[model samples]
Structures are given as C-alpha cells and as structure tokens.
Target: MDGRSLWRGAVAAGITLALGIGNASASFLVPQTALPGKNVPKYRDPLPTFAGSRVPATSGYTVSFEEFKQQVLPASGGFGPTTVWGYKINGNGPLWPGYTVEATKGSPATATYVNNLAGPGGTPPLLQKYLTVDQTIHWADPFKLRCMFTPMAAGCFDPYTGPVPAVAHLHGGEDKSDFDGGPEQWFTPNGMRGPAYRTYTSAGAPPAPANGAVYNYPNGQEATTLWFHDHALGTTRLNVYGGLAAFYFLRDDRDTGRADNPIRLPAGDQETEILIQDRQFDTAGQLLFPDGFPSGLNGAPPNPTVHPFWIPEFFGDVIVVNGKSWPYQNVEPRRYRLRLLNGSNARFYNLAFIDGVLRSAPIWQIGTDGGLLDAPVPIVYPGRLLLAPGERADVIVDFTPFAGKTVTLTNNAKAPFPSGMAADPQTTAQIMQFRVGTTVTGDTDGTCDPAASKKSGNKCVLRTTPMVKLATAKGTTAPGVTVATRRQLVLREIEGGGGPLEVLLNNTKWSGIMESTMGTTNTPVAGSTQLVDYWLTELPTLGSTEVWEIINTTGDAHPIHLHLVQFQIMNRQPYQANKYLSDWMAALTAAGKGPGDGPPNPYATVLTDTLSIGGQNQVIGGNLLVTPYLQGSPVPAAPNEQGWKDTVVMMPGEVTRIAVRFSPQGNPIGGSVGYSFDATDGPGYVWHCHILDHEDNEMMRPYIPVKP
Candidate 1:
C-alpha cells in the first residue's frame, strides 16, 4: 500500500503503536512490525553539521519551510525516503534541524521567515496525510472552524488538511514581544493570519511580505545557545515534530566561538551540536504519529469523550539525532564541546557515556539555557546530565582517556519524567556512538581543563575573567537586591472520567473571560476571599525583580520555561499536595466558582464560564500559601543549575522557587533597567510547560512588562 493508504488504514482501524503503550493488534494495524532500532546499523551514517554567518548581517538570512524527502531510516533497513517539512536556509536544500545562525553581542541581526508548506497551486502538503490535527484544542484555527467552541462539534475530530500556519520563536531570546513569535502571532502561506500576527521591520529595512515575518534580534544579552522553532497555537507539537527547528548562538568577547579566544574552549571542528529526539516510522518508512487510536501500543485517548484525537503525551520508540537514526560521529582523542539540546516533545533524558561496563568520561558542564556558568560542573558516574524537553546543556568531554575505544551515549530517564516507564533497552536507551580515534591531534588542554580548576573564595578558578553571579548561593537572592513582589502560582490538571481533559497553569485557559478580567476593574465577592476583579497577575514592572513560587499539584514533573529573560533557580521544597488542593477547592467553592458556573460568553473558547480561580493576589483566597504546608526545608539547586536559566524542572509535590528580573541577564541587581528594545509593546510573552503536549493545551500563561 502507498503512504496515504497506510495512513488512512491506520486511522480507520484506530491502531496504536509502542513506546510504553500496549502492543498493537496484528490483525488490524497496517504495519504488523516496525523496523526494529537494532536492525539499523549503528554508526553507519556520519553526523551532519551546518553553520550560519559568524559576522552580523541584517537581511541576507532567509529561512523557509518546504516539503522534501530525507533518509530518516538508513537504506540498508529496506526503507525509502521519508517525506518531511524542514527549513531551507538561503535558498539551499531543506534540512532537518536547520543550520546554526551565529551573532555577536550588542549588535543586531535580522532574518525573514517564509511559510511555504502549501503544495502546487496552494494545495495541502503531502506531510499532512500523516498528521491528525486535534481541532478540539485551542489553535490557530486558520479556517475559523471554531471546533473548540462546542464539544464533539462537526469537523472537530477530523484532521486539518489545509494550509499550515507557522511562526518562528527564538527560544531564550531577549527580544521585543513582536519578535517573540507567540502562539497567537502565527501566519499561513494562504494569506490567513492569527489574531496577534504582526511582523517587525528594523530601521532602514523593508516591510515583511504577507506570507512572511521579518524580525530583528537586539543581541544585548550574554552569549548563550538559543534555538528557533515553530510556535503556532495548538499544533506546535505537530509542526516541530515535522522538522522545523534550528540553532541561534549569541556570542560575546569573553566566550567567543574561537580557539584563540581568552576562554580557550573547544572551537571550530572540535565543537558540535547534538539535538536528540524520538520518532516512530511506518512500514513505508514514513513518519507515524498517534491519532487517539483505540488499538495497539498507542491505546485510546485518555479522555476520548472530550478530545477525540488529543493524547496526554507521546513517546517514540526510536531515537534520532541530527536527522539520522542511530548515527555516530568519529572523533579524535581530544577534548570537544558538545552543545546538547533535548528537542523531544515529552521525553526527558538522563544522558551519560559508557565504555563497556564502566562509565566512560566525566562531563564538564559550562553553560545552560541562558549562558555560561560561573564555573564548570563536573558530572561523574551515577550522576547523569538530566535535560528535560526544551532544555539545553553546554558541556565538554575529553576523549583522550579512551583512545581507540567505542563510547556509547545512553539515556536512563523514564518517560513522563520523574515516575514513568523506563526506556526500551534496545531502542530509546541507546542514543548514539562515538568511535574515538587512537591518534590525538591538537590535544591542548587550555584553561577550560577541569583538572586545572579548584575552589577559591566560594567560586571555582577556571576562568581568568569572572562571570556575573546571579545569586550569592543557591536559593539565596542576589546581594543587595530588594524584591518588589512575591507570588504563588499553581500547576494543575483538570481530569475527566478517562484521564486528563486539560492541564492548566494557574487554573486558567488560554483565552476567554478569565484572561479578559485581568488588569481591569476590581470588586470583592460576598463572603469569599475571591474578588470580582484583580490587577494583572504576571505583568511585572520592566526591570523589576520578583520571586515566583511554583506549586505543582500534579503527579508528574514539568519543565517550566519563561521567555525573554533568564532567571536563577532559587530552591525547591516538598509540600502536602492533597491538603493544598483540598483547601484550594474549598476557596473556589466559597467564591461561587465551580466547574461550569456562570453564564456562557460567545467570545470565550474554553473559559466561557466563571470557573477560573482568577489571576493575581493568589494568597488572598484562604491564605493559600505554600509555606504552611511545607514538608521540609528547601533544597538548593543542583550543581549544574547554579547559573542563569530560562527553563527549569519543577518536580511533583514540590514548590519550585525562582528569582526573575524583568530585564537582561547582564543588568545589575537592585536597579530598574529594561531592554534596549520595547518589551512592553506587542502581544507580550508566555511561560509554559515545555512539553509540547501540555503546552498545546492550557498549560501556558502570558505576561507583559510595563514601565515602572
């Protein structure tokens, strides 16, 4: 059967596949057996690399999304090319995990992104045949289907086969809100636009076309490894899964991407990027995604009554890195810098290198999602590098010790994070291989050598120049900075009879009455701690510092990411989740807010009723503070997480605290300073769970910065 026929057959049979889900029904599922990951030769394909302009340029960089054929599974596996949608840079052939774009600090760089996913004469692309767009979720709604307005509405459960909507979001970028590429700022190739769509043009630059967006990045922050990907509403998981992501490296004088620089870190050919993701393929060598099928490993959607095709989480059996499955890189026995990014939709990786039976090498962590750390963190055996979805880690590994030996990179982290199913030994557990060459060339160990580092006055003496420390110590605030406010936020899940209907951040929806009531009038409700109106909750004064305590009431761990600014991880403490949730429900009941209370609003999608606990002044309701229910003293951040970070891991039953300053990372504490660009304008920014599945739901919130 052809690819389209196989997709239709799979959907019609409601067949599910594996990756911790139950086994598929052999009689009904289209593909009786998938290509076993072990059947594909390890280290068969060489890792691919691409780099952008090092010097600053304004208008030369252009990236577009187009459909192409790629060898995802090797030809030896008896599979043909897989059709995918990938980024084509500067009119070149499209590539998955597109080329890396480099920029210098304090200078500006601009790029134009075009949406070309439509086929001949503007028809739906062929890749759509494999995707089952869940219209029940709040999405771009390019055709204005408004499926989310009513449960099981007509066409709500059908796959979307129209022009694809896309917008480029530079993760961890400190740019203006217009260039943030928020969920509502998406645009399609067929002249369809989202509600908050707006293109930014720099001074002396041309205006953007109707099908594209021009964005300027004022590289004012410290040097860090940032990435760009699609952020279209609801369908982010689908868009990114179809290959639409690239790297953006911001550099400064201190940490230049050169060997001769002061840092003397690994550079040029010695440095490489390793992006890890999970995927599943069909018998025709085509990408396969679960569409809430009832049989096989995928099983049925947890809450099929509410959402027909939307699953809580997705886990693939095969691991792919740099566009190839089970690929390897031949490296000399010398130190190399590996910029690791976890781009999976939901899986978390506890990565480590093993040679034979023993651990191979110690990983020296130098930077995180934001920028370089104060000192290198030595990660030895038993302590693997844990990276959740959308998180990045900059580390150095010296292969000098294991000359001529083969080292295997492995992952032990479970699916669904903290407490989920273990990785399959033959497939997801093994990431890639490194065949270390016996001959060591250019094996110079500079200041970046971990052995040369020692403790000095509460800091490591690895660098001649000092990095601006975000805090005196983990969980402690930066010295002399006065906090403006302290807020308690909640991560909650609304469940149905089958499973999770939707996960919410602060018990609110993406759009509707709850969001509209924020930053407006105020009135106290009778005999309740809840108020009729509350000032904007997350809107912080530009350049002001605040402490946000995130209370996770769910059973799983979540990777919470904040856009625009990188903050310091304060600490995490255990709490009585059940007690806190009971009290929270009581507060909502007292305030006359139930699951489906109040009158319906035609304008609202998910929050038509007064079901929200509302934003701002969360402590007012029955003094719902996490401090009283704390189970123990706070634990400081891990050694690897002592630096500035834009994304953090929030564990279950714990209150994770973070100190956020609504300004650039280099800004001095205690001073009110804003970015060079206007961050207060446009559609603002959002903080959400990096799990694309949860993010597509309501597990995201928008925050704007206002001038003090």
Candidate 2:
C-alpha cells in the first residue's frame, strides 16, 4: 500500500486498540466562571527591576529561568496554583512575564542568562507536565538529532522528555549576531549546547556560570519598545507559552521615559506597560495545550504518520493581560501612556476602548515596533489598532473626558488574522476593563493632545524632533538613498489529506541543499558535516539598502519580521495568486527535479510516489519577479504603519513591499556605513513570520550580511 493508505490504517488501528491511552480528559473550551474578566488585579510592577550588578561593574545584569507557582484563577473558583517557568531578576522573583530590563541608549549593557530550568538537583520541574515537545519538527534535539534523518524513526516520532533547552532572543534589538539569540543558540540545563552557541564576556565582565551564556548589547539603536523571549528551535511556542518572556525598554535623551525628559511624555505613575495574550487552562487551573491525539480534545493530526502531535495553529478562548486572566486596572482621569505588546502565540488583536456601545476615547499611536513615528496617528472612535504577535505599539490615551465611567478594552480581530473565525463577544472579544476613578486627580494633559482643537495649523504637534522619513507614499526612494537590489520572496503552504501539513518560505527547508533559479546549488553552511546548519539565503551587503517584495499566496495574512534592522513599508498591491503559483510550479517541473524534492524531502518523496504531484522550486539567487502578475495600483501604507517597523502585516494575494537598510535607524540613508558593532560575524540573523506556530515550522529563513 502507499504511504497515505499506511498512515490511515495505522491511525485507525491505534484509535481502536489504545482508545483510552491518550489525553481523554482534555477540555476544548474553558468555563466562563473559571476565568471571569476583571476579577484579578493587573500585574504592573516588575518588582525590583534588574539593576546592573555593581560588584562586577562590567556584569550588566543576570537573570535565570526557574519554576514557580502563581494563582492564575481565583481561590473562590476552587482552582489550585498553576506552575510556571519564569525568569528571576537577581534572585528576587521567578515572576511570570519577568521584570523589565531598563537600558540607556548610548550605554552598553551585558546580560548573563542561566538555564536553570532543571531546578536544584537537575530534576525536571513541575512545569514539564504542561510541555509537549514535538520531536517531528527540526528543533533543539539535544539527544541524538534523529529527526534530521527521517521522521519515521522511533526517536523522531515520540515526544522529547529530556532536559529542556532554552535560548533568549531580544526581539527587535539590533545587536551583534552572537547576541542576537538565533534559533540554533540553545543551551540546556545539563550543560548541553547547540552547534551555533557562543558566549561573549566583554573586557572585565563576569564569567558566565556553567550551562549559561553571556550576551553584550551596545544599545546603539533608537529608543523603542523591545522585548525578550525564549527562541529555541522548534520549542519556541511551548517555551514562550510557559511564561518565559519579559520587556526590555531602551531609553534615550529624547524619550527618557521620565516626565522631565525632553519629549515631555507621560512617565512614572502615568505610564504603564501592558502585555496581552490568550491562553487556556484545565479545570484544575493547569495549562492545557493540544497534543493532536486522535482521542484528545483536539482531534487527530492532519498528517498522523508524518507528525503524531503537531497542529497548524493554536487559539485560546480566554484573554490574558500582564499575566492575569482578564484583569483590570483603576486609572485617574488624565492622559496615560500605555505601551502595548501582543505576546500571544498566534492570536492577533484589534484593540479599542469601548464604553458600552461607543468607543470611549481616542488612542494616539506615537510609536511602532522600532521607535517613535514622525507624528501621532489618531485612532478615533470606530477605529482599532491591530497588533500581531511580537509587535509593539506606544500610544497615549486621554481618559480626562471619561471620568467616573467604566471602559472596556475590547478586541475584534479574527483568529488566524484576516479570513478566520470572528472573536466571540463574551470571551476573546473583551480583553479587560478600565475602572476610571470618579475623582479628578492632580494630572495635566500634555502638550501633545489628541483633541482636534489642540492642533497647531493642520497637524497635531506630537513631537519637537521630526523623525527621518524613509519613503514617500508614491513608492519612490527618499532623496538621499537608492535601492541596491530588489528581492522577491514567496510564502506557501503544503497541504495533506486532513489539513495543512506545513508551511515554507520560498519552498525551502531549514537545512540541506537547495537549487537556486540560476541552476546552482547553495548550502547554508560551507563544508559542514552536521545534520543542520544555517540555511542562508538573501545575502545582502552590509550597509546597503534593499527592497524586499514579499508575495503571499497563502489564504491568510502573515506578520513578517526581520532581526537586525527596522524597515519602512513602501506599499502593497493585489496580484493574481493562482497564476503566480502555477508559474512557480511549472518552473520547478522544468528543472528536472521531482515534486517531493524540497526540504523535508522524505515527506515529499512519499507524496510524489502516492499522489503524483510536485512542489514549488527552492529558488534563490535571482528574484521570482511579480511584475507579470500585478493587478491593480499599489496601496500606500496605513498612517499608523508609516513609521520605522521591525514587523509588518503582509495580506493574502498581495505583494507587500518594504525598504530595509541593514543599519541603525538614526544613521544616514545610504553609503557603506553599518552598525556600531560588526555587521558580518557569528551566526547571522533571520527573517520569519511572527506567528509562532508558523515560525516553528519551516516558515523561517536565515540570511547573512557580507561586508562590502
């Protein structure tokens, strides 16, 4: 029989023979009373923030991962404490969504991260029960790397229950590649490390402990809202879901994060950082994740024979903010600067402030993933701010007019983004409530007000210093710089009998040999005998400006993010997706390669023998130009997206264009000027879809910067 028939037969026999051995007690839906909104207080303070160790002056900060318990659900609900794997700041708290690391712009900061997941005696912690590590995908397989050969191997198909591996990535931080925290830089509690793992200790910095790595950050970029999270190879989704994330604030003289600073923005008690996420829990308040078992709450896997317990996407019913389940915060009747972050694994949020049926106040977006925009974009009533996973927004919300009223922070974005199911009104739609204090406190609305009457001339005076604009709305380069090269990339999904089996960027896998469109073979690493190496493509010259045209043929939109530099959105134009896909397939067939010869070629081999189909070309070198399939005029970026961004949304059936300069945003637009640190060194950076599920799959790709 063929592979498909064999898979079907095996699934049927397993379900019939071992029906009771799987996750039978799992619940698909969480009860309302278990996590009612506004019951818990919002977690704001990152108690005793990481203040660099003074004993060893060069030892910037030290943090470690440890197991802890927190009351996720209320005591009246009869749910016990939930176990969490969290980061501790100087042994103070193993707090969920760990404490913020505050750094100055020009000063350099060094951090030593210790992998202490296996507590005291190197024993696995209680949080291990909530982890479901799918070995089928390419991950930090510390044991044998069996999956590198074939998924049918016994070691590859089973769950990984060994010492967990972890790596910390400072999302949106423009640092050296050694400290960028790429996927292959993982380390385990037992002193095991990945192939690309490297440790750096500046001049007099303290040495890293056993099973630890030290990273140094020059803090050379613009002041922005950046975050740090677990980014181990395939287990990023699980590690981050287990509460291994925290905020990292980069402050400068202009936006000093204090009220008396040059920008005159809200500070101290008037400013707050809010992290919004979605999660599910069992009846006992323990975290519940889908394992793709036939008899489990989540049904059978799409391709059971290939992957026993890997799902396409995950969406939880309950909304969580700042480590609390639908929590609330009481605020005074004045302007407050709220730095928002969407930390969910897959869920996208379109947030607004609603008082009953009407939007209560305007949300003025002053900054994006990179830094402050040229001017504030007013999101008035009936408008919502969209934030995908790993995206951040800095906004000022004036609550002066809504005194003595309760306003709810609501979400209306669909799951899986544009074309997915709508958010339920009673559950995922309502994020949190803001109970405005009845009394007017001692606060003043800043000079940058959102009201129309406060506008100077035609535009609202949001800032005194104007940010550098990179591109105009007409899709032309700004006066100073010119595009060095235009690269075209494609996003696609591979389907199985049940649903999506996996996704790929440019129809290539994470490792192995790939043939470019120019009929030349290029491997990620040169002369490497390892199972997996950096699958390098799209090599751009250091200090050069390039325009990347991302063509998305998939059904859903994806949030694309780059590691080293923040980019400018040029435009997005609709295209003929079907024609483009057909042409791509034809190009693959003409190259004398089998349909199932892409990355994870074994799975494709099985499909080709059984289904008689082919995959797209694993092309690089030359661009898969989109000009022939273009349909309409290009649409300019939204007002809020005009600023410097490290992540931007690419809609389906459209070609989204972005101009990226491989340097800090404050630098001049053109020439051979690079970063404060070496731009071409260590394991290079990566660009991938922000959807953690997609990123964990084959949707991520690495690129190196070559010094000119």
Candidate 3:
C-alpha cells in the first residue's frame, strides 16, 4: 500500500504517536508530521475579544459558528492537515483555540450567535461515521432515531446521527436565567431549537437577528476568569472536542492594565494564556475519537442494541496547547503572568516546569477559576500544582535566572485522575517547551512587580473587601443571621448489566419530578423528556443562604459544578465509605429518599462553584469494594484558593460541604447583595459534573432558586 493508505491503517489500529523510524532528529524523539498551526499568519495573536456594546471602540463583533477547514494538526508530525469546526469571525478560518470575548463589570454586552454548520441532520452526524456517537444511550435526538430490529426492545432508540446543534454558555457568569445556556436550550443551524430555548429578552434588549439566538450578558459581578463554550445537551463532548472553547475575561476598574492600578497584575504581551487539551489523530490526518471502549471498561450501553457510541471517559494520545501539539514558545528573561486552563475532555493536569539541566523554575500562583487570590502562594517546583478539568490556575513564572536555556513545562497528573492510569511519556507526560531568551527585560519594567509583591508581607492577606461568609449568612456560626435552609444531597453512579450505564444526581434522571413553584408551567415539551432528563430539585429561596453537603459515593472523582451563583467551599471530611454508602444506597433503593435516611460525614470554610470529588480506591472482586486505601486525610482549599471561586476539586471518600448564597452581597470586592434581575424567572439552571463524557451520559441535574 502507498504511504497515505499505510498511515490510514495505522490510525485505524489506534497507533497513537507518529513513528520517527526513518528520520533522526533525536534518537527516540518522534518527529513532526506537519507544519505547526502557529506558522500560519494571524494564528497567534491574543484572540480578538468581542465586547458587544455600543461603545464604538469596544463594542463586540458578532460571530457565527461554522464548519470550515483549518490545519489543526501539524503535517510534520507524521500527520497531514485536519478539517475541524470552530467559531469564525469575519468569515475567517475557524481558529482552533476558538475566540475570546471581554466584558466589563456593570457594562452589559449583547451578541447574536449564528450556527452555520453543514449537514448530517437528515441522517446520522458525519462524525458518527468517522468517530463514535452511541445512539443507544440517552442523547440529543433531533431526528428521532430508532433501532432497526424486528422486535424492538423496550427503552431502545435507534441512533440518530444528523446535523449538529449549537449553543454558547458562559461558564462562570451571573446572568439572567434565560441567557444561562442550559443544555435543553440547544438550537440547530436550521433554527430547530431545544424545548427550553429562549431568546435574549432581558427587559429592553433589541430583537434577536434572524435565524440565531441573541445572548445579553450582564457583567454585573466581580472581575474574574470565565470561559465560553458549546453547552448543547448530549453533544457537548463532540462539539467541544471539535474545538469551540475560549476564554472570557470580566474586567473592572481595579484590574485595569494601567501602571497605577491598585491590584497590578500582568497586562499587554506579558500576560499570556495557555489552553491545555488532549486529542487523538487518525492516520488519514483527521481528528480520531472512538464511540465506545471494546473491553467495556466503560459499562455496556443501558440498551446495547440502540446506543452504541457512548463511553465512560475519553483520553487522547496527543497534548495540544494554543492549537499546536508539542509546540514551543520564545520567552524573554523576566517574570511573566501565565493563566493555565485545563480544557481537556476528561484528563487532569499536574503541571510544573523543568529546564534542560533538569532544574525547575520558581512558580507562584496568583489566581484560580474564579479570579485572583488575595496573596501569592509559592508553588515549589516538582510539587506541581494539580488542575482538574474546568479548573484554572493564575500563576507567575520568573524566568530571569534561566535565560539562554530551554525549559519544558511538564505534566505528571494521572489520567482518569487520582487513581487512573499514569501518563504515557510519548503523549501526556510532556506538555510544551519554552526557550528563554538571553536578553533580559528590565527588572521592574512589567506592570506587575513580582519582586515587590513577593516581599509585600501580606502575601497571605486578602485585599478584596470582606463579603458575608457562608457561615455568617447561614447563621450556623457567630456574627450572622440564621440560615435560610440546609440540604444534604448525594451524587451516585448507576451500573447496568455489570457494565457502566449512566451517572445520576440523587439516583434520579433529568425527567424525574421536581417540585416546581411555577406549577405545571415548568413542564418540558412533549416527547423531549425521554431517557435523558433532569429534575429541578434543590430550589433555594432567592435571597437566602443554604449549606449543601455533597456526598460522593462513586470510585471516580467528579468535578461538581453549579450554574448561576458562585459558592464557597466549606470543608471536606473523611467518612466510612462502605458503611455510609451501604445505608445511603438502601435508602435510595427503598424510599427514593436521600440523606434524610442516611448520609455521609459533614465538614465545613471557603467558597467555590466547582469542587473535585476525591475518587475512592477499589479492588477487583465479586463486587467493587471501596477500601480506604487511597483515602488519606481530608484536603482543604489552598491558601491561594480561599478566595471567591467558581470551581474547586472534591475528593472521593469525603463529603464536600459548600455554602451557597442566592442573592449578591455587597462586600469589599465590588457588588451588592442581590441580582440585577429576576433570577427565578425563565428556563432555570442546572448543576453537573464538568467532565464532558460523564456530563453527556448522565451526572447532571437541574435546580431552581425559588422566590421567597
């Protein structure tokens, strides 16, 4: 066979890395098969931010999501060019890392998102024929797919692979309920929309443009790191994997780039962002993703004959940064602020820097998924900072001492997280390299003075105004009013036929009944609530405070994420895994009740919206038995993580408690104690595991904050 056909066969066989047998760059190092995306003009600039306002200078530009051709993978790395879909501005190439949108606090912005992707709508998605899309499992079925069996089994729907659906969700923004971009609000390019979909009708907003959903973002919260990406139900994994995620920065007067700004962080070229993700490539030089696992490590589909494309987790063999695989960056000798976002589908990252001489750099963390920390935390090299999916780390790397040397940013985090497989050297181990230039930038030249800030003595001091602590608002401790309520919820994963079927919150599907204050008006449209559905339980009073203890009983760590409001992480405490789970499961099976019957331990401190649940260790036996093997002491939020946050890691075998305040409280940071609009109106919100695969299959639930 010819070289092209041979490579195609190799990809079909899942040969992850391209071979460098014939060429010799380094003895064992694999060679590049294609040119780097960075080499293309206009590919490396800080993505143009869409400030969708009328401020002529900063008003955002309208963009559309379309299927276009761009060189995703390099041709030199034993791979050719790749055709991928992405958001394009001014009809440009759908840039791989996508685009960024900036919003200022209090200055609202509006944009109409248009979906122009091509066909597969009548039949199955084109991707399904190339990759995997298990139609048997519960998923978005705009075409009403069904199996072709003579005797159709109960609860079986044939896989419907068709035209793609698209929607944009601002991950950590406090916006009106309708603009929240919940899964059920998906829309196709032809204007076919999900049941819960709504247009941007925030009071006096302008009419939506033809054939698109208009989104109005009220950037009324504090300045922090938020991201925008496709959040369509069921197809989120495929859409994101197809390349549609980017950063969204909410700025304020305090975070101004001027040298006189009180909180001087890095700005201009000195401030950089690295979006780290993983992917697999086919031999034909296209993106390769499987729909199922042959060994069934991911349990069989709930209905084997129908949904065949779903899998438990997806781990890619190639690491991508800013749209290039194993690319390099040239850095001058100075302190540079770096924002690291773990955008992988399911892989976690433990990142650190190593030089050619094996020496590591002094790293300091300044921010997180939400925003900047009060004080800088020294990140000792080799003690790599761990970042789970959907998490962010705002850090500074001082490269003055390592001038003229090549330093490599490395990853040691295991896949599937905490207890999963260790990283393979050729793929996940090494992320990217930095070539430090010998020419030194002036010592105190940058906007942020790292040397002075290091000695500020208040490195541990939080400078933001003091907002009401969850404890104070909940009345559980001194100096606060009584709490509005307290609730204990459980996160569970259900197994079918010994193979994993799906995950659920409170052991209930999305279609499960939720006590809606709106009465029958909240009902989902007929037929839309099928195998995969969500329940709007945990409805909190609009202006009250409540503490929720999330008990995770599964073996895998889940990054629990909540929508609309930002919460604080109270604390995590160890519990008798087998004991707590046994009683909990009994109650769930017998009475459909939660912690009221049996619950895990409770520990209570800080606030966050996303927290990672620690995965428990299990041994192979008649049934999966949880052993306290990997359950160590409870892990608390780091000092740098104590501030306001949207996402935090929840350890397994531990009960993670969080205090959530529905109304805003004016504190030192800058906002007031209430929402600018009626938060309880419209389609409502949801909470789910941020891992794309788990979220797509199950592991998610809807929640409505009630009116007091």
**Model 2 agreement with the true structure over 449-497: per-residue lDDT tens digits:** 6554644543345456666666675765577766665666778887878
Evaluation by TM-score, superior candidate among 1 and 2: 1
The global Cα lDDT (0 to 1) of model 1 is 0.74
Per-candidate TM-score against the hidden true structure = 0.88, 0.87, 0.79
Error of 2 at 5 (Å): 14
Query: How many clashes (backbone atoms < 3 Å, residues ≥3 apart in a chain or on different chains) does model 1 have?
Result: 3
User: Looking at candidate 3, what is the lDDT of residue 3?
Assistant: 30
Which candidate ranks first by lDDT, i.e. highest?
A: 1
Error of 3 at 327 (Å): 1.8
Q: What is the lDDT of residue 302 in candidate 2?
A: 73
Best by TM-score: 1
Worst 10 residues of 2 by lDDT: 606-615
Model 3 Cα lDDT, one tens digit per residue, 615-689: 111111111122232255544555555655566676677767666778763332222467887888878887888
The better-scoring model by lDDT among 2 and 3 is 2
The stretch of ten residues in a row with the least summed lDDT in candidate 1 is: 598-607
- Please state the error at residue 607 of candidate 2 in Å: 32
